[model samples]
Target chain A: MKRLKLFPISRRAKDLLAGKLMLLLTILAALLVLLMVAGLYLKSRPVLASQPLAELLFSTKWRPFRGQFGFFPFIMGTLWVTGVAVLIAVPLCLLTAIYLSEYAPARVREWVKPLIDILAGIPSVVFGVWGMLVVVPFIKDSVAPFFKVFSTGYSILAGGIVLAIMIFPVIIHVALEVFRAVPQEVREASLAVGATRWQTVKHVVLRKALPGVAAAIVLGIARAFGETMAVLMVVGNVAKVPGNVLDPAYPLPALIANNYGEMLSIPLYDSALMLAALILLLVILLFNLLSRAVLARVERSIR
Target chain B: MDRRKVEEGIFRVLMVLATGLILSSLVMILLTVLVKGLPYLSLEMVTQTPRGGYYLGKGGGILNAIIGSLYLAGGATLLAILFSLPVALYLNVYSRPDARFVSVCRLAFDVLNGVPSIVFGAFGFTLMIYFGLRASLLGGIIAIALLILPMLIRAMDEVIRLVPRELMDASYALGATRWETALRVVTRQALPGILTAVLIAFGRGIGDAAAVIFTAGFTDAVPTSLLRPAATLPLAIFFQLGVPVPEVQGRAYASALILTLLILIISVAARRLSRRLTRHVVK
Candidate 1:
């Protein structure tokens, strides 16, 4: 009997040991983000020390061989592409989400959900290939000419259009979830009060889902900001701030990707590129944190 | 009242149009790839490595890239599963539901999931320099593994969290220790979800180009060792498209088609496997 009791204690000890092992692994996994931030910062310190942060961020000069690294144009390029993408994607995705959630039949919703998943699953490189073969030609041949502007088809608009398409599935998926999360009774109550379907969607459903919708948009923007290969392929990598949507502009990711191989040849070039990556990481981190905070608040309020 | 009705009609039409537009674009993308790729895709293109002046529209296939991608992503997935399973299990089983540490870890994973693949590439390159490692298959695996780690863990966590609590209680009632309950009962119950998460991470890893471009330097031959430079299908497409040769460009489309088909198969398999595995599931 005493031996049997000791058996249970030994089993308990084994359980405790297992728990401690898992805890250590979990902590190591969680510390990866901190490791990435610290590594990038330390590598970028040379450029950060040589130039003032404001000058590095705000200056327009970018002579890599001469050791000058102004990132203002790339920053602006990122903003322009992401801004245009958001402007194009949000309305279309929101409308699509509304249709799927409120208007489409259950069968149709089931069919379309998988389609959106397919869209999301399509690789970015494939999208770049399509953008190059189709969107760029269309822009150069039709859209730009119609707008009375000349573009080589590689411009901020091309990047934005491709990016908008890439982000459509992301926004639509999230927005559909948000819309579906609205209690069925809430919709019934509005309808019972003689509210039109559109009215309920515009007023009550939208109101209840406003935070989620905002979170979706923020997520899309974050995606647009950091996309590398597709945008790099389409956005003509001119090292100047784009004056209009049709102008070719270089974004930061492209700068890092295109020049990383050759950066070792030039002084502070690697540092500058690392700093670009650091900035990208910081911005994306901020956007993600903000969206999470917004989501958490809504979840708490709902509870 | 009439104006409101008109407004409703207009918005309804707008919604339908927007949805139609999105659907049409999907169709367009698929058609573009199929139409452009079919003519160039041959059995040889899948069988042989690139020969002399392949970029010049000469005789050769992308077997190197196809094989290399499989190796890189497959190795990375295995590596990620090693870390992801333990972390995910810990988050769902070893901690309290409302534990502060658990929430913080969840939040960290969420943020990490949003970090772009390019950042991983850049960071991996930094590590490579520090460790005096060259761009090789091993480097690519490490980079892609990190890129997919958070995604893998979060996906598994979501699935493991959905396992019925009562099932765990029953395990405990049977005199199973917490570790036994977690490993045997919880994991068995969540097997379908765990498999789905693993496949999703594998798909993401294989499809990703930004994370592997710098870490996996292009090579004509298949990777023979972990330290050798490797080619991937996405980079193959990118490089081939950059060439001004029309035939080379056509091969790029073919490569994209191959990659797309691989992803489609994996996704289909994941759905089918999960559905089949749920036979013993309680609900």
Candidate 2:
């Protein structure tokens, strides 16, 4: 009490000041996404104003020098690559999550957890390098030829494979958390009712964890969609709609990454690129919000 | 019953195979980097800046990128912490966890976390153009700081939330204000977790490439001022690999090796440091 009197302000005032400051910071943080969206949208207004949103989104022509910016190709490219990645990654990750949650010994689980972290921690550039060195060549020489297709390996399939590997940790980590959140009593009850271990996991744990798993998959799709460097390295950056997995695709992030620097001099080029970024931001924002809502529901249901 | 047993055995095998496949990919990625990089990774690669025709397989090292990345990530991490710590503390100590404001803040961070690094790069570039700032270390720092801020806050919040309510109550009973209780007691209790969060942000900041690519203009010289352009190892790897020369491509592997080693060291050190600091934690 004696020391408290040394302050120029009352203790209550100091506490209020600190609390206010923290609240302000939190508010600022909460407002950042809107700030980003507004900033990007303002910058991209030129292109958005020049062309109809539908034409811009649905048009496949992407001639910047000619002042026509059609994002259809890039949008489709992103979808194709992300689609391939999600298709390949979900089953593999779900199985691994189940094994770790339902079947693995404690020692193995301990070892794999850190391993997943390390995998997740590996820089995207290194993954790019690995894809460039191994996956691309293997696809070029072996996989493509085995399918009797003559192709350069830098295709949507290559991008998808690399993206799938990059997102393994994201999916597996969340899936593991979701699986663990399934109460042990549920499992025990299933076992007591004469369900085998695998049966219990399939019927009880998996059903309970379904929403969480879907959320995880959504997060993974968000990750794969926004991935830039590794996909850029392998997914031959041609500005065309990829008809098949073997064709080159220019994804939106890649479009922004590859051209934003060099083509600033072109009329409306930067705006088009900003519009691409806005598209990516919006889609990712939608996915993240959706996943968060689903996760909240899962938490509520669990409780 | 027999058929059900067969199906169980089949699924068990599938699960094991899937797990093995995932783990082996990690091993394979590491092995590829090491095998391809070791031959080109000379001591000079880390010590000297690039010389004339370095990208042509002639001479020099990636020291510029090495130091530049350290500076950029270090600066960004510090900047992020300045903002992140307050938000994290406010969430746990000053505000109700279930408050609408808190949920909105948490939701904001989640969405921001999911926003791609390329989007950050684009947004940062837009900001720089508006402010008439060139692509420089400062520009990169601001971008990466924004990129990692949400992550840092969320991670710190998770740990700070775990601090026992009783600890804060005891501090309050001793006539301490909420400010003092938060800064001294709760923060001290969550020190290790805070450290881990900081290091994780640092790791992410350093390893990031797409966010910095446009904002951090690459330069051969090491950056001496915040206004100057700086190179990063990931971009260095990217540029080297793009050259058609075999030797330059080999150097790309060397650069990737350096970057990977840096991240590995950061993660390992984070774990070790957290373990050491845990002794001081009340829990």
Most accurate candidate by DockQ: 2
TM-score computed on alpha carbons, candidate 2? 0.98
Error of 2 at B265 (Å): 0.6
lDDT of 2 by residue, A157-219 (tens): 999999999999999998998887888999999999999998998899999999999999999
Per-residue CA lDDT of model 1 for B55-106, tens digit only, reads: 9999999999999999999999999999999899899888998999998999
Shift of residue A32 alpha carbon in model 1, Å? 1.5
TM-score of model 1 (CA atoms): 0.98
Q: Which parts of model 1 have CA positions greater than 4 angstroms off? A: A1-7
Q: Which portions of model 2 miss their true places by more than 4 Å?
A: A1-8
C-alpha RMSD (angstroms) for model 2? 1.4
TM per prediction = 0.98, 0.98
